[model samples]
Target: MWLLLLLPCVRADSRCKSDLISSINITAKLQSDILLPCNFELTLFKSDMTADIASVWRESPCKSELVLSLNVTTALQSDVLLPCNFSPGLIGLNTTADIAAVWSHRNMTVNNLVEITLQGQTMYWKNYNRQIKTFSSVSASGNFSILLRNVTQSDEGLYQCDLFNGTGCRIAYQEMHLRFDDSPADGFLTWLVTAGALGGGVVLLVFLITIYICAKRSTNSSNESVSRELYPPEVPHDAVEYTLENPIYDAAVQSETHSSFRAEKGNSAETAVYTAVKKVKRKERKPEEVQ
Candidate 1:
């Protein structure tokens, strides 16, 4: 009966010793590189205290297995990244233990651990050149982050972390992706060029219209001038009609008078007889015939 009671107690003791690790918490914007933070708890002997951590790996939602194992620290060094930070109270593994971190796609690793000593902050990476660039964190106790910068699309992968300096290890994991985006400057420049073209076109159109108007006005002025020269204001004219029928008769009468006077002077009797015959002929003719 006592063995049975102890059996339940032993089972409870083993269960209590089991390590419980929290899942990594990660948040990031789309099209930006992110480092999914992974942290874990571990049970270790006092001799097993070192900065090196082990059993770090990564898994993706789309995959069923682990991808890359990080053993060499040099391999974890990013061309554009700073080193990671180790948790303080949980740090100091045995010197013989190697620093190992593994992830998917042969990219993730644990290079160094930052000692966190403040509150209200955590460590993360901004990518750079297809690798980690910056590591930053804030904690109330010790260094707590590895930051990366200038991440490229190819740097996207899954990551898992563990404090494995001892027999018992704590584990946590997160997902990360790197994204590349085109520059908006190109779009802006294109819009600028289009606007410039449109403005130029409008100005050109206005100029053309102005020229046309000026030309039309000039043509109209020239036409007016020509019209004035060709057809000037007119003057009124007065018209009358007259007909002459016996102008030569008047001249013949005068000549006859002069000749009769000259002949009468020479012979009074001949002249008196001629004058009486002439006067009788004149009385019988019309008044218009006498001239």
Candidate 2:
């Protein structure tokens, strides 16, 4: 009996933990739809049964309060049912609630009001006109999404959404932005800068190459000209080197002639015959001329 009593007390304490669990997730785009998902887990204070389950929504984390609520017995096969028509324990309430998605730019607030039934049913409101701007929102997508038509700089700002029930509320927020299109002037300037740099580099390279080629050509021409100017003229292949032997031969021939002359003056027959033979041998030789 004591064990049973202790178990009930422990179970009761777990049920009323007082910590409200909620999470908000969103993705913001300029000219597109932004989806913000609201997920919550509720634990009843006295019992596990979701008899009087209530959720409230607020903004500013602590200041803004009571945006919406849900208070109906949800059908098992409804669209808002967590994890399909099954898992009845994941359902927040016995019935689906009206979830309102709000969008704010500057200080202007455009309320996109819609209802989502159990098992994720979405109700869209067409022609829900907001102010004239570069953005539009689809109020029918009960998934707390802000759909902007055309994005602009003026459309950039903060946005918020609130999901609630009878007990409390959960809030989700986001930001939007608009930017100007790039001008042709900017693009042209960029292209011109790039082209100028590339052209300058090419021109510099070509100039250096031309200078090098001219220098090489000039060097070769200079070498050839110098070689031509400094070279000695050609000479015949058969030219001979001068020597001292020619004078010696002339002296020898004159001495021989003088001796013969002396011998003839003396009228010696033997000397005359010998001189005549020597002169004949000399005439027959016909020696090469010396330089």
Candidate 3:
């Protein structure tokens, strides 16, 4: 008789234990963070209580065996998005349902990163100093995804997402594996490009300077050649010597003429004349032909 009364609770527990399984693998670059998608649809039913004792009874229209696995890779100091969403239609449009989501990491010292609670149109969040965040209107859309800001090596681990109904019974479960890349090659490549640009600039400057110097030397040499052509030097001439053998008058003739003129003109006026003379030596001829 007692077993018959507990049958309903056992069946309800078994139904809640059934889950849907999924798997995903992602390869992300070191430049940006990665998004892990976890989306599913569920039907939530109203809880029932037994008359004799207070027993929570819940139901779900899910498969017997369901599993979801995600592999994500990202860089250090990058933000990550762990997506988790469910269909809100099954919660009923005119009815109010209490739904809660909890995000935790197994390897992290602070396991509970975020906790969200939704009561119909109202939503509440509990996180660690805003390090983890979720949508403000999570109740309307049934999106329980969390954002991890500035992920580091400590954030690389297995993350679990659990969903509970008003009765505090877990209805859904999800798992995600976070990982980091071995090396960050993007930063190194950027550095290399910058260095190459600087080197090219230096080489270009040197080439320009060399061309300027060569042009200056050529211009100077051309100016000197033009000056030599425009102005020439004067040449020196040799001097010549001259000899005068004849004069204007003889000295004895001039004296005799002067005396006759003085005697003839004893009672008249006398005239005087001036002359310049140069003497030369004469060579004698041989006189032995008569002997």
Per-residue accuracy of model 1 over 213-240 as CA lDDT, tens digit each: 9999999999999997876543221221
- After TM-score superposition, the amount by which residue 263's alpha carbon in candidate 1 deviates from its true location, in angstroms, is 56
Candidate 1, which ten residues in sequence have the lowest lDDT sum? 234-243
Output the better candidate (2/3) by lDDT: 3
User: Alpha carbon lDDT of residue 35, candidate 3?
Assistant: 97
Per-residue lDDT for 213 in model 2? 100
Over the full model, what C-alpha lDDT does candidate 1 score relative to the true structure?
Answer: 0.43
Q: Give one digit per residue, the lDDT tens place, for model 3 in 1-291.
A: 999989988987975764766788899999898899977544433344232223322345232222356887888788888877656643345325566667778873647766676642323345464567677476556677778889888789998877666655666767889998755586788788999999999999999999999999999999999987774432211221112433233334444534544445452221322222322211112234434
Candidate achieving the largest lDDT? 3
Model 3 regions more than 4 Å off:
1-67, 89-95, 108-110, 119-127, 182-291
Candidate achieving the largest TM-score: 3
- Least well predicted 10-residue stretch by lDDT in candidate 3: 234-243
* TM-score of decoy 2: 0.28
lDDT of 2 by residue, 1-291 (tens): 999989989977876676756756666779998766655544334453444443332212223343332222222222211110112222234443443333333337664433333334444445433422211232223333433444444444433344433233333333333223455676798899999999999999999999999999999999999987776344331332223345345434544545544444574545544555565566557663331
In candidate 1, position 247 carries an lDDT of 31
Q: Candidate 3: lDDT of 277?
A: 31
